[model samples]
Target: MNLPNQLTEREPIDPKLAVGSSLPNPKGLLAIVLALYLVNEEKDHLDYSDKSGNTIILKPSLITSLKAFFNGITGYNATEIDSLASANPLVEMQIEPLQVPLQLFWKIAKINILGTDSSSGERTGGVRFPKELFFTTNMDILKNVISNENGDITNTGKELIYSWLTNNNTPTSSVNIEQKLTKTLSVFSEETLFKTWNNSTEIIFQQEGIYNAFDTTNATVDIGGTKEIKGTLRNLKSSISKDIHPYLKISSSNVELKNPSLATQFDNYQKRVSNYLDLNPKSIEIKIVETEEEINVDDVTILNKIYYGAPGTGKSHKVNELLKGKEERTERVTFHPEYDYASFIGGFKPITEVDAESGKEEIKYKFVPQTFTNIYVDAWNNKDNEYYLVIEEINRGNCAEIFGDIFQLLDRNSDYSITPSNELKQYLVKELTSVDGIKGIENGKMKLPSNLNILATMNTSDQSLFPMDSAFKRRWDWEYIPINYEKSEENPSSHYQVVVSDSISFSWLEFIEKVNTIIKENPNLGMDKCIGNYFIKAKDNSITLEEFINKAIFYLWNDVFKDEDDHIFEENTFYEDFFPIATKGKEKVLKILEKIGLNTPEKED
Candidate 1:
């Protein structure tokens, strides 16, 4: 069977909680996040309206603003970001404060803005933070909200935070942020402090933001080692003042403990707290490692996701790593209604055997191993590892009939089921001649061994076939394979160097785009035949190129039209209002064929 080339093949992946694939597009992200929330809330309709009556659908403006905010704080603490909402909350959630590492997100936003030049007053490196974050300004109102009726900017900076949110909807420009200030600056009106003020660093209220709430206690600190062995960490409230407390860090190796100058106090406090609490050390690797037997279904290469897709795709190349030229150990079977249990499972056969009474060879019943029985029984007796059964053109036969009772055995999820009652029981009990080259088991049923995998190839292009049954379809994971054509190394500018190659190179995306435009301009064409599967059987480079040319000619003629011997290579028969039929009329077909610049030269191969 000819298999088309596939464009992408993901490396073997472990099926743990790998970060989910990125949403297809930005809009898809919004939809998925919304869908998750709505599902969680059990709401029949989504609540698009904000606390205010205004709807807040994902908009280009909002997305742009968000991107800016993320880029602004490129280097910040990760633990500081624990409050952000996520698609899966429980997985990323951390109950303890020390477990929060603040450095993770700092790098993300930093990367976004690195080397980027900004047009607006935003993107300034200083803490003033990309100005896009402060797009909305009702600062005074917010101050007033947290402080009941207190309009004084100097006295009410902290108190007015609560009232601002209650009075209006969630402020659009980076409104939701909550963190106890490690260091605060005083706020003052010109009239209040010095009475006459040009801007000065002098403060009206010296106590503002000057408080540290959590203090340090005891620690288990090391003198010098990269790996932190043991440590004590604590979040203590200062007896003198709540804001003056420190966070302690502890470790067996003090080398890793070295950091920014201000880290000394927090580090010492963390060391004390960890030992006092008998806590685990810092820096835990987060990769989820799974045991072999408990391996996730994704991680296990069942080899079932056969690369079947749009034409020109590379399905065979994907298996090149395993099947380049090596002899195959897999059992390949073609299913047809004519296939019987005798060919699938072991069957009782009458053969000549020596009988002592007759002193001559006599017919006796013996079991003959079938394809399914061979591989399965081999693994049962000898654990020589993996066994495979690849069925090509899987749907060509009545699968349910040909497969009979074995479909359930091959199912991905079915581990154990009662022995199928019918002509299969005795055959299922039959043993194979070779068990991975070892002797076989006499009474074992034909069980699908743990390491056995099944690969079935199907072509959706086939018009005649029963729709794949639900029981059969539900178990297989589907992967859409795309085309990846082999490009030639010839140069066209110099005819001498331009060695003509078969199947001219074309970008799938570009081709699809062109087709879309043609469909829009001329509605009469049916997409089904518009070169849906454009593959050429290349006997050699020359023959291959000819086959490609013929395919193009047929596609141009038959796809956008019907039979048209009279069609010119440059005529226009398409009408503005006429929708294209599956097969175009002779005249229109000829016109389109000519329009598309197609021709087929007779070739002797």
Candidate 2:
């Protein structure tokens, strides 16, 4: 139950080695050294003098062995290799023997890049130790054994071991092991570590894993000899930082709480650390002003903001502008009528898996994650960066059905924290508990981190498609993008002329203004039916007759006026100008314009 001394102790071992011994030698010797280090006892320090006449010098220390092993295997200097291992947020220190060594080997098989045969492309039947033992690196031993002859160690047993370590594939400088080690460390984040731990379900440090088991200040040794969390959080922090087991098994009944509860508390502490890493403001203070006034602050924290406007009103454009210049994680998804909980969050899906015993393939259902689950986990990991999830056309889908139990996550207290339902709590714990380097879960609940912002864009016209209840709307701060026909004029480079046949060429800006005004003034055609200037953008500053007819005209006919009576347009000109191809030209369009008294030829000049 005691936290390992490795978590709380570091010794300065000033290692001195023989001159001219730093150059790259064969990897076989390095593997033997590493194998010896992994299988050594607590007091045992590796020494090259034990192997008679061997000039290589290795000091026994985790950091020293890691440095020498990496330097020798990949020709990188010890300093550079040391940095590579330390760069990861989580560093797995002790390789404990819980199950049999062979079973443990298979447990880490996915992460093990070693132990392959090269020339024949097969697994080498190396030495397989029968029993599970601490500090042992599981692998087949070399067939060649070094013999002590004439007071000197002879034979290439170390070289054979190195070949076994690298799966018999001698790594060249072009395809070296250093790059593979770097990649493994880079991809090895906290979440993945927790996932591996959860998968392994084995203790990282046993009672005898380290020295000075009883000598600790941050934690207390209970009667049953298990270490318990003291009032302070220093021990938990140290344990997690060194990748020591968070909760140790205890036999004492005097402990204030059980190991499971202590683990949960430790997890919550990790979540706060994750929050602090992102530099996001943890608190938000809102003051109600007595009068109408604008308040500006040097620091802004936008948690959940939604934009609503008519179609083509530049809602998405505004979102991009808001996120500009920020080094953040951003994901976008659109909600439609068919969008469901399984697609938004995650749900079980059927897949085929080979049965280990039967050696036959069988169908099984596993939880497949979608957009929300991915962003949720990412937000926890990259806490130092802002994470934005943009939901475009949120109102188009049934929000009630999509959020399901997760709807409760939207209800933040004054402190901007959320308490999840029991169902959601169980689900989150089950799915995310073992994720390495992840933090911020508490009592089976989580709050949307201050850095994780949910931005949604809703077309006001599509309100009828899926009505968002008052409860849902209340959770989000809404920003309205007003319809402005002259918006194109704000950026003259985007302005264009709409042409229909030979005699009809007019400014698209003026056409939109005129059409929108008519639609607004007509009681039957309300504001919802009014056109936004960006509905049909000009191609090369000139909108062709065909382009305008297909995009703008089609939308007006099908989306806007479909519910309106035909008499809304003067002399049924709307239908005639767009109906028959023979009459759907400049002459017919001009006649309709004249009928509506909108034909202003001088406007183009």
Candidate 3:
């Protein structure tokens, strides 16, 4: 039996029949494979029945092919097969043939495993490639069968089970594993997932099957959602032992820890599994659940709010935090000087389209919907769900020019609906009216859907770029993100520290606070151009002196006090310490701030 090259000579096998060693059911197949070897050794027969009462029979012709294939791949003679199986045994290989999709057969030149769905060729559940065929098969042929596909998972339940076997590439800790399991279980009902994992693990023939700790009765502690996986891991660790260490050993089947040698075997298995998981991190399967949160559109008060603040005040971060889990419904766009009506709203744009018959690319103009219009249609389609269109640096673009006719949409009536103009109506009718769930259009006028929410962020410094009129400003509820030094320092997550030469390293939080204090005190340089804590972040809780001079000092010298009184720059208390570094070009500038000192906190002795 000669093997064909799977890569170049691509071939398709009968999908209905279990071809190749793609063992979809690893636990069951492992039992069947082990049983085949054991039965052949003890009784010299190829007959067995699994827990499902499926009879497995191995044919001599298939066995001969497997023998040759094994010798060809492993370079072992037929006589050495048993010894090969005993030493360095294939206990659990991740890329099981049965678990892989049928379409993946094209990936490997259609190498087929001969086995019963239960055994060999008995046809209990249908014709399946036997376990002996899998044991003798090339391991490389079975690798990455589930992964390397750019499509949706056809069998999500099987993929989750596979994740349990492989542990999602990070086996040392159950963090990534549990995350995958939690994400996978999110798709099914809490009850269904719990039941599936519970029932999937059953010792077949009482002697043949392999089961995992994740499939155990104790592992089914949580099927709630992604949030509950951490608790589930804790339950598993605590429930297993009174005193669980960082690395607790979960034993393999029939492995007793009565002696040190037996305990060592369990540890080895754990290490091997962990290493395999680290290598194949992508193997963990998860499904992002739609409609994770339930939000009522009517209850929303601030329908149009602009988060206004100084640069690096975390206005965008605040918006993300507000819509943390509901990211599917939100779309973001950064506005700039070039942003205009055509880019902000739907317009006819030249796009290249390939002519299918001619096989040529042709330039044509089509009505392309922009961020706002696209979100509008999507919100209308999903009326029950609230949608957000986040505009970053809203002040950078000319609001009047960019908004154009759609600016009227901002004017909401008592019920929070806007009447569109005749021109806007023609465009909406042509582009959106026919779309699913797009209602409320009447007499060439339209209303903003109740579910659609517009969120924008603006930097106070960039407010001069496109000064919004009073009417436009009136429409939006302004939320100010103030620069609070105390609040910045209080955040335990930000471990940002600055270590300056010739001075004690101070908290980045403290440095920004001191700078902002001086800026506030100066009449000419007020709050408008004050430095925020987020302006200069420390890399690994450490900032270089050069970086401090470049970012923190440069900003104050350039932008903050550019047009302000030179006396403000000459403040001895504020500008002294930075002058020695600021000397090369500006003699007058350095003379002014030569004695400017920053009240950085002294390091504790």
Candidate 4:
């Protein structure tokens, strides 16, 4: 057999003649049986490395057949070969008994199946079979069989073995080999064969003859002969009982079962101890630790939420603050008046590409994913982590038109799904088929993963631009962001001062409080048109004369008090009067501040 380049070779085995009744390890016996079948068929070699780095050479065809056999028993379609092979930790534990059987095959059966080196010691390892030992139907039967954790053959193993032996065409010469295998299979039984084999091993025989004492009726089995140990059985039973029933009382010397029906289970536990002693034959310690629960994404009651407030009230800032450290897990999009479903979700976009074979520039239209699709796929692929899809200025665009049929997914009470278009379905199927928990993506329907959260911001002032209907509005949990007027660290804008000149300045928060009171009193201009504390940001804690007139004065004149008869501005005063170039621009702004009950300080000398 020629091993693959990734495998490492081990030292040559020292060939020894057959001694007493040393049975082959169950997993190793299964490997050799499969190897014999493949050798008869002249298949190419397959190589695998044990945990100790020793290379085990077999046939590549074994992977496909073994995968099918395992899938039949497990009832799951295992796509990767490694999932069924020893590379998986669980599978490795199941088939680890191959170690002792390899040595036994060489010693007892005179098989040189273990790899060897060339004359120059180049380590060219391969499998060599004797001419007399050819493959048979019995070999195929043993290849597909499975064994229990105790190394005993299962019912499936027994059925396969019986079918192999009952065949009429079985050669008479093969009966001798099959009989030897039957004897080897008996060695896995804990009751009769193990006790007989235990007598030959010196170390196991001396352990108070405990193997013989293990019966269903026995209340106590001695571990230490003539030695009084403190809490020995209590500690031993405590560790093993975690796997067994808890209906047992632990004394200093013995573990007494509360019920008589548990005797068989206790007897099996004793057999496991005997098996461990037979393998170890030396002093060993065992310790058990409790494993911690796995971490998962935090649950939220509101899956879809929208923060609504006036402009410059930190609605977007609140969303960003909640997702402060998790920038990588979040996808952000800003909605506009022209925003459509294709732009928010996904659509086919034209791409200019150069053909590799023809060497010509070609234009192709491909389905391209936008913010929604990008975050949706990411959330499904990584279900253990939380993902965010943040939409800024959500009310600026038509909600019903932009969300389209995807609005059905907002109700996460159940696994709400929507059938995507043909283009999106094909793209999603290609990306999501390999992932485990994600379903319906391969079929045309799609749902948001539980870990995905959609958060949006809406300005109450712009809510009338593309008014959302009651159906769409009720789907989202609405939160209102109120303006803070108190001067504090969080409300930095409260300390800002609007400067009309060197001496003529007033507190920005005080000005907002007075103007907001008037705006609230008016029926047309309510809280929606009220000036926000942070409507205009200040430079170095001071709102310059130019900044104040450009932002605050502009908004109030045009938006808030544009058509109101009871306005703050002087009679017939145009918006251009707030400009510096105007003759009475500065004087007009001062009179309006005083009228709004804001203090206008005298100019400095």
Count clashing residue pairs per candidate: 60, 14, 27, 1
| Cα lDDT tens digits for candidate 4, 216-331 | 57866644333222111222233223212233444443545557786676567556657765774532111111111111112122369998887777777767755553466789
Instruction: Write candidate 1's Cα lDDT for 553-587 as tens digits.
Output: 34544544444443323445333212222223323
In model 1, how large is the Cα lDDT of residue 436?
34
**TM-score of each model, in listed order:** 0.37, 0.48, 0.46, 0.52
Question: Which residue pairs overlap in candidate 4's backbone?
Answer: 1-127
Computed on alpha carbons, the lDDT of every model, listed in order, comes to 0.33, 0.46, 0.47, 0.55
A best-first ranking of the candidates according to their lDDT comes to 4, 3, 2, 1
Rank order (by TM-score, best first): 4, 2, 3, 1
On TM-score, the leading prediction is: 4
Best by lDDT: 4
Question: What are the runs in model 2 whose C-alpha is more than 4 Å off?
Answer: 1-300, 324-328, 356-359, 413-427, 430-440, 485-494, 562-568, 573-583, 595-599, 602-605
lDDT, candidate 2, at 305: 75
- Displacement of residue 597 (Cα, Å) in model 2 is 4.7
Cα lDDT of candidate 2 equals 0.46
Taking every candidate in turn, the Cα RMSD to the unseen true structure, in Å, is 26.7, 19.9, 19.6, 22.0
List ranges where model 4 is wrong by over 4 Å. 1-302, 433-437, 440-442, 581-584
